[model samples]
Target: MITRRRSHLRAWALLGALLGATGTAWPAEAHQARAQAPALCTSSREPALAARMSQDIAAALKDRDGTVSVAVHDPGRGLRCRLGDTRLYDSASIAKVLILQAVLGRAEELGRAPTRLEAQRMKAMITRSDNTAATDLWQKLSRARLNRVLREAGAQDTVLGHDRYWGLTRTTARDQLALLAAVSRRTQALDLMGQVVSSQAWGVTAGAPRTVKVHLKNGWLPRATHEWRVHSIGIARGTGTTGTAAVDYRLALLSHDNPTMRYGVRTLEGVALAVHRGLAGGTAARGFTPGHRISETPDGSVPSGAPGPLPPAPPHPPQEWGTFPGTVPPSRTARDRRRAPRRPRSRPSE
Candidate 1:
């Protein structure tokens, strides 16, 4: 009986060993299975959708009347699409977004939301694109503070020059899009945008009855070449009352430096419409329409030919300067003035 018991015990021990080995191998097999599986972003849904959006954005710029650079970002899905180089455009009113950000951050640092009066001015700056309000806030915010905010917010390509000039501050559509995306997610950065929008005297971008929730800021520099440019960054959240859930579409458009002549408002309307159509899954317009119509030789302004490649462009203008809509001008730093005036540098005597 003892010998039979010992043999049975040995058989049970061997079986237990085999089971343990199989159990350990199961995890390895599972990991291999996962590795072999296609990544979802790379698989069926998102990649294709992103590609389509990219195609649509490119087509829209081609069909539009003037020069434009656009960027769309869907952060949740890790999608980014661009239709132009990263060079600057006249910020027009879009710099208002930065002003808004600066004010809120300052307010937050002081441990309070802006007062009723301050909030009112901020709203006017953002929604109405009022230049005076923008200037007031710009003076209050200062370049040093604004730079700190940009650095803190992880905005790499954005810079604030002296407030009262068009080219003083430089910002790109991609940078603007990134800011809006972060705000749409209700990040701390967005809290600043919301606080400023609360005081808008009038709203240009949020006018739709569907109430596309826009947390935006715009800039225009009209004092310079009668050209107008607009810079806006925002999320078009659906009108909650209408039962439309917010779609995650972030937009940044720099429209200026084109041959067209219409004001920034007209150009922005086209951009907003394009965004709305994209969200609705509609294709962009086929033929071109200048976002602005320029007059030629004071008579036949309809110069017809293939629109040339977009001109080499500069960053959008800042709010303080009343100049070209979206062009950032060179600064008059001491170094800037030290160079010879408009003349080629002479070679050293050989």
Candidate 2:
């Protein structure tokens, strides 16, 4: 019996020594589970308001993975909150809004209205998150022109994509806030953004009071490296006492490395809900309700076999910009088959 006990003890000791040599052989996901949550960094002139927002935002992001950046501005209240607002992420379809700004700015510069083709593409690009339409506009506007618009908007932290991959452009929450402010003040882009297809209007609107007019743009793209980059920016106009212009507020939320698109959307909505509630003096607002009807399609109907709950394709294809004409191009699947299988290229998340 002593010898048997000795053998068992020796076996246990060997196992312990092996484990110690290798440290703990935990699975990758176990390490991820043990990772610390992100810290919320926020500031506002209104100390009480700032405290509330910081607490609310931190609570909303508790235990969530990935990185999220947010910036909020309420001019009437002189309130602002920024949490990781300067961190950059791939812009995805959100860049389409900037493209719209470029298109309008260029038209204003040239002292001409958008041509019929330009109007059509702009409509498709913003309202529907249409990649082909965005590509058409991106090619026409060129990188130099888009960069010029970014500069004019005072969005210093934004970087346009290399070549045709507009979705790959990098931007920060603070930069997006600048873009939102520009849209709010300018009529051209603001008018088109107001018509954002109901199906695509889920982010900032989720937390806003129903009476407020919401102009929003959302971008979502999934990549092998980041899992998903999802972003939303908007201007909200609150209903005030009659005979007064509504109090306008702007918010920008950018996130990357989300486990899924829905998770990212939920995170954004949570942040929005908190901000709107704080801005509205703790009044509760309606949550996100997807529109039954899809907008911006050829027939304004949801395409058959569309991925449920996933964001639409981003504003550029995986390939370089070719000779795109004014007309809307074919769907991605058809285009892929027509071309020779080039080397496997990184697909655009948007």
Candidate 3:
């Protein structure tokens, strides 16, 4: 009898050990997973808001390819949300924003606004996303000068691109958000960003209510490694709404490893929309009307030979917003061609 009782005890202990190893024990596999997975997003001011944003962000990213990072801030609401780590990515045309900031910083030291030449460069760099303007400003400032501005802005993790290739500077979403706060402190900076041409204002600005003024900048690049890098940073200031109803916030969304430019843009916008909704006190996210998807123009302009007429391209075929759309669109002529069809090739004197 004693031997049988001991044998039964030994079997029970062995079974318990196996169940625990497989996570099939009383605590349950689901519980173990929940414990192991860290929160993707967090809000310092509101836990419920953080939880909601985290869940929605995770849902939006389900099955989505590539690596993404995000940061959201609303000082008035005392809410902040962060997702992903501080992995670095190419700055692309987003360097235009940094260059403008550095110029403005220098002007501030001189106790004046941008010089006429600097003003022109700022307008082209921010509003038109012009590379020549960016390069001119970047070259005018020594690397030490630019680094000084970045350090003042609290962008500790950013490293400027080498050899005047300003677009290749490496940065993280956190650093971008910091730069935004620093830049926005100046009305001149805010005004320039707010005036970004309509064609270039799609990323963090997507699905935002017109009531909230959006000041934004976006960047995209393609390299042999990682394939593509796309990023957007914006401040959504709700001047029209009052109290808790206001949706005033700033967001930085960065991504890489996309298979194509359009893919990267879609990922950034999807995450942007998610952040917007999450920041709106958990309101339902608005849809980003399926317009045209832009193509490979990392300089934030229309590339040669896109599918349809650009900028306000046609509404059919459901294209993604790109750095081009994230910044130019197809021309009216391109749209006309896609709609009318190629009237069949002429045989001529064959």
Candidate 4:
């Protein structure tokens, strides 16, 4: 997996060193996994886990049409898996995540908190995928402000929707990871995302253990050429198995040319389930032991009442961001494939 840049590479190296000190055999194992694994993906610390994830993800794509681009980040374990990482797809309502950030961030810039009505609209925008709410917020949110949010988040491949159509923005898996990383830091923003109506919370969080607190946003749209586009960006956290520290992971899955919305959803769900199993453990958490820290529980997991405060997680290694070979370019027929022809906008999501 490519780290986003040199800095991320250095950060990941630092984490590997820390893991070495902590009796975690992840660094060397991760290196070996990379050497042995296909270019599609890799995992650290556990070759079996990485191989299983790669197989499961590929199986999910088998006999399916359209493209599915995946990027998975596990900072605690120093793991990353990517397939078609930089492939561009329609943002659909996924851009609302950036809109949400712009709204809250603009409020902060204005030297005030988001007002009650703004907060309500923002919550509805994220939790219910409400289009009217998004439109209202978009009217008040300027492109410049949105650019500020994207720049702050390191969303390099994302282009703001043309003529103020946030849903139509073009983006890639790597860039969405950047947006999620920024959103993960703000308590109120993440809280709204976590409150997504159960009906709307259907993508990357699937099969995640109840112990994991999942905050995610999913979007889908149908068009003439690609048929349908479905995408999801998410952050999951739970108690790390090795210590009191928490497990921090972010995943982005993007797809287009699905025959139907449900098919696209299925493609993402299979990959997501495998991811949760691979990272957090399925049936039982594979690496878990009794009596771990409860003091700093971030995901609201049940506390073990162990004495010490939460240990710090391994330093988040920068993601591999070097140029990768498997990227699929945006389709070129409509508007240079930067975007599809504008039509009467449908509701932003399924």
Candidate 5:
């Protein structure tokens, strides 16, 4: 299985490098005007808890050379730990989930089939990080609607500009967590994110344990600086019913302009490890307790038996500039084949 994964990685890597070398252009657009301005954060109950978490994160990130933002949402608590200013940081691929939410919301509003080609685009946006699809969805829903949805979802720091993937959207750790909490509740404002859990995009890959049911979205982008560093964000939802009943938790991280952490998958894995330990009992986490280990790779990288390849350039949304194999010439096949012309299963087979 590992060998097969290595092969898959190599193939994908080739596609990624080729796309990058060839230059798949993603243009920046102007920020859209929203129907109403977003509201500022007014309150949070877990301020003290959040402060401790922030201190821990700050210490852990002392020499990390990048800004780190973290938010934790347990059963009753919605707390965030932020080390840096609450200013918007580049969201990288994480923004795709927001774009996905907007796309799904539009689908719901239009009363159109969620399994249509456009819906497939939403899946691509989330699973594959297709920039063009994100852009298309952005256009379909309009910037105003996107901002309103995000604002209503409580992700105030998330602002969408016209920049292509890895460039346009900015978000803070606090806002990212707020968005995650909103999704967990299935609020009307965040109903679109429900599609992320129901979509079977994760099933296309391997490594995550069958016992774990993950509803997640990931994002990554390389820095334009000379170091050419990478930044990434991952949001996940899993229930203990799947495995390690104690593993139920929300994980989020923001690594700014990381020169050494170029591999998007590795970057996400690091964050996942910290969260898993915090939830599953680890000395690393000053507060959390220990649980069971379902699979070593908690960040939901390659599934079990999946081979590791040199990390490829960040995945681009369709139509946008960035490195995405499917959008490149010669390989007309979409990376997310499951989201082809037909509708896919609404849920993964249990």
Candidate 6:
């Protein structure tokens, strides 16, 4: 009887040890699984607002292909929304913004304002999207100087293009947000960016209310590898309504692998429209209306008239500035073809 009792106690002890071991192993396994899980999309705001924004943005991108990244900061509401914010995309003409920033910042460093010629080039580069002006300024500023400007702006993930190809620079939506935020805070840069030629202000501006002042830069390039890369970054401000002070927000949208430039534009505008409505508490009826046509000429020199015969060739062939992909809808004419400068035979990368 004693031996039998001892055996039973030993069996019970073994069972308890086995159960304890299983319990410990299960938590460790569960922890490992948790660690490997991917992060869900998120918004930093009141639960209701966050959910609505997240849902709306997701809906905007539901049928889209390729990759799109967005980052928005609305200090008035103490809110932020991010989706693939760190992903990199080709800068395209959008790099012109950094170029402008570099020129302004470098001017401050040199203890002098930009030269008259530099100011003209800056205006052409930002407002008009002039590639020749951009190239000239890029050479003058040099990569080292521009890199310094980027560093000072706290845009760590942005890289200047190699071989003087400013359009090919790699940058992230988050980094762009940092730069746009700086432009909003700095008076000098804001003045120049705010003057972005009315023709080029379409993407993010399409969603802004008329009362809100907008400063923006947009870029588009169709490359063999990615199909199309279209991006827009901007700052919007207006009077506040919901207990918040003045409304101030910055947004960065980047996309690639689009089937066409028009498609890309539509995608961006849709997302922008949703974001503006969600943040500004505006209804769809008050949303922005995109212009009927889009412009590819960086100089904003498209002639205002009907298409005419090709213009006599100039002394030097008109260098292609920032040319949007063939897929872009022909909207505005900066210059008449009969008098228009001849762009290069090869399509510009931008």
Q: TM-score of each candidate?
A: 0.56, 0.69, 0.72, 0.68, 0.52, 0.69
lDDT of 6 by residue, 1-350 (tens): 34433433332332222222233333333334443432222344465676567656655764455567888888766778776688888788888888888888878888999899998998888887888898888888777788877887789888666666777778999999988876776676677778888666767876665556678888877765666777888888775435345778899999887767767777788789878877765433334334356543322212233132334457965445436555443434643564677787996787
Task: Give candidate 6 regions above 4 Å deviation.
Answer: 1-45, 241-244, 283-292, 295-350
lDDT of 6: 0.69
Alpha-carbon lDDT, every model = 0.50, 0.71, 0.71, 0.70, 0.45, 0.69
Which stretches of model 3 miss by more than 4 angstroms? 1-33, 239-246, 281-286, 289-293, 300-350
What are the runs in model 1 whose C-alpha is more than 4 Å off? 1-45, 63-65, 182-212, 222-227, 239-246, 260-274, 280-350
lDDT, residue 22, model 2: 35
Give the distance in Å from residue 339's predicted Cα in candidate 6 to where it truly belongs.
Answer: 76
In the predicted model 4, the residue pairs found to clash are 2-320, 2-321, 3-319, 3-320, 3-321, 4-319, 4-320, 4-321, 8-318, 12-317
> How would you encode candidate 1's per-residue C-alpha lDDT over 241-330 as one tens digit per residue?
334555555666675533333443455555455445545332322212243332221111111231322445698765643477676656
- Looking at model 3, which ten-residue stretch has the lowest summed lDDT? 301-310
lDDT of 1: 0.50
Model 2: runs farther than 4 Å from truth? Answer: 1-45, 240-245, 281-285, 288-350
Best by TM-score: 3
